[model samples]
Target chain A: MSAPAPKALLFDVFGTLTDWRGGVARAVAAAFAARGAAVDAHAFADAWRGEYQPAMERVRSGARPYAQLDELHRENLDRTLARMGFEGLFDEDERDALARAWERLPPWPDAPGALERLRAIALTAACSNGSVGLMARLARHAGLRWDCILGADLARDYKPRAGVYLAACAALRLRPEETAMVACHDHDLAAARAAGLRAAWIARPLEHGPGRPAPEPEQEWDWIARDLHDLADQLGAPRP
Target chain B: MSAPAPKALLFDVFGTLTDWRGGVARAVAAAFAARGAAVDAHAFADAWRGEYQPAMERVRSGARPYAQLDELHRENLDRTLARMGFEGLFDEDERDALARAWERLPPWPDAPGALERLRAIALTAACSNGSVGLMARLARHAGLRWDCILGADLARDYKPRAGVYLAACAALRLRPEETAMVACHDHDLAAARAAGLRAAWIARPLEHGPGRPAPEPEQEWDWIARDLHDLADQLGAPRP
Candidate 1:
């Protein structure tokens, strides 16, 4: 805040600010219940997400055709549903609806407050893997107030790529010093930092509902907060 | 129409949508006149743009460190101005103002009509090498209405790169098939096609102001128009 101030704030979506897991589980639960199946969809939700990284890596490394999260999510869900003894449990329409269920995830308790705080201090934008259209619908569905959205679909490369980070900088017409990345995941922060962006952390303890494993933050950060609300408090931003 | 509809339209900024050359020339003309200088700024404007690709490519290929278009513009302007005998005619403050002249770029005459039409048909977003912050400033400066902005700073790579386009698609939650790239340049559309996006050609014959080279479409496109007004006409979308 002294010399080179941040002109914008880039946020990580998913668990940091939204309850994607809970949303997925709820959608799956309803889908199964309507189908008169007793499948444990909560477990299915966790398992499907568990397979996410590997599936994306396949596309990332060119092990498979260029595939999107929507397609990858569908493929994994289909295989997982069959293994869970829910064969023919749903049709194409149901499957498509479930795939888009991630778009309807609920925002975390502090998301609104944090976004307001960030916006007050600087422009707030989303830098996520979700498509721009998906982000818009998600915003509408979850009532997120993002000034704009940036995702892998925009840069054609996933996070941790400097090009991805740089693309956001280009669009904002800001130098790397002018932007800060706020994310729950440390790896993303590390990438942003490596690209010369300042970093802030908003811890999301139950990103995967406690059972699923996620990488923990190891590096020291410019800022650390219990939640978006805490960060807002520290930043002296307006309360949502 | 049988396919999943595009939820958003991602537009190319520079020549395709906005007349960067004309705008920059006007900015140069105004800046020069404001400083009581009698130089032909229009020539410098043409020469300045000529250096854009090479400078960006230097970063893209690591031949040079990453520099924003603004920085690059200043660098090129200073060199070109000195060469053109733009001596003590302008001071540092005037020079800086001239450098930011890019920010005050005017949209092509067709921009308002086309954007209005696209807005009625789908959410409209700008995908350009201009930074997100730059685009935002330009939007306010030019009164261009965009749902959002995406660019190199937003994604890191330049136009021919897929990051921001993919990011735009992800942020919009729209598949490549569900979104189309709109631009006056063929290289931009070609890249969009390679990424599996549909394309719209919005031609601007006067972008180079008479003698400069312009691009030609190399691939089959979904639609082509002489200008934004024509593009809007084909879509049957009305101006706001």
Candidate 2:
């Protein structure tokens, strides 16, 4: 059966709306090259992102008290650099720029246009693990027109935690059932669905890296589409 | 001396961006007429708004938890109706439609264009006491292109409270010095300045009612302008 129409669409940003892996890898290569460092940029990007969950888990598990994604990303970069034996290669300015790469990731091919269409029909916001500021900067940098920025900082917790999903809904004054969570990752949708929000999966075959298997939905979602455009069509938003 | 340049322009919506007094009066008149009641529409509008601060004070004083402005407005409407000797005249749906009139308040003549100009130069958001959902709907309804919805709901408190100003800045990841609070009210700017945000006062002489004296700045603010257009000009935002 078709799910009831949602009044809002809350999106997962990193892998869903934008190609963070590719964008981060490109940014890393440029930053390192400027510092005369030789590194596998893609590998570096992967290593940095790989720490994302564990870093957030520190807060989620109550070991940390809700640091923003930006701070965690910076710390992760420091640890990753140390492990890669490139410690102290770049100065503080260089390190800061590298960490900010997350804010400048390019949107997926269909994201900008699809978001415009979807926004015309219902409220659209970033419901990600990113901090509110990170989301705002990313939206501005990537031309993603979010109705509002909602995420970890607002909830003071990370994803898969009920607070994140419920906080986004609360920020919009919407009921969980009145909102839909859109993501490429099954785990995100699972958590959203568990929190009583409708879920839609968008396939991003290469979100992780080339040769990575496309995500398979762990459960039946309210809708599944090839990209944001397809999802917009499914949501009955008129194409411009 | 001129103030430091602001990276974001946070706006007060009710009277600064929209003519709430006029809109509310019109809505109230229509609703009462539908119920075959003759009431002083303008007086009723003023009285309804008069309760706004007191209602919010309940939350601020910890006597009540934060409630959405929509709920407060409804309660205020009922109280105002009863005081006007028209209690039980309108049903719940009618009361709801009247309360939602705030969502449909028309933008001031220069608001849409001036905001477009200002937005191109810096981040722009509705930093009002309105709930996130109410602000989002009002933006959509009135064609206010906010970068993000921020304010009361996010802060979980009302304006003139330090938390509200600081919360909006925190959401955008901006320092108080990097943001400017633009409002027509002296009290709001005073509170903003107290919270360390730069303040810009825009004159809305008719905000309260016709022939009402325009608010004179009680203290020196960073910038004082005739309207949003003048503010945009002072801020070096290019006119389209």
Best by DockQ: 2
Taking the tens digit of each residue's C-alpha lDDT, what string does model 1 give over A84-174?
A: 7776888988998888888799899778766877777776788886666667667767767766776566566667777677777656666
Residue-by-residue lDDT tens digits, candidate 2, A166-198: 988987888999999999999999999999999
Q: Which regions in candidate 2 have their CA more than 4 angstroms from the true location?
A: none
RMSD of 1: 6.0
TM-scores for every candidate against the unseen true structure: 0.70, 0.97
All candidates' chain B TM-scores are 0.88, 0.97
- In model 2, what is the error at residue B154, expressed in angstroms? 1.6
TM-score of chain A of each: 0.90, 0.97
Which pairs of residues collide in candidate 2? none
lDDT of 1: 0.76
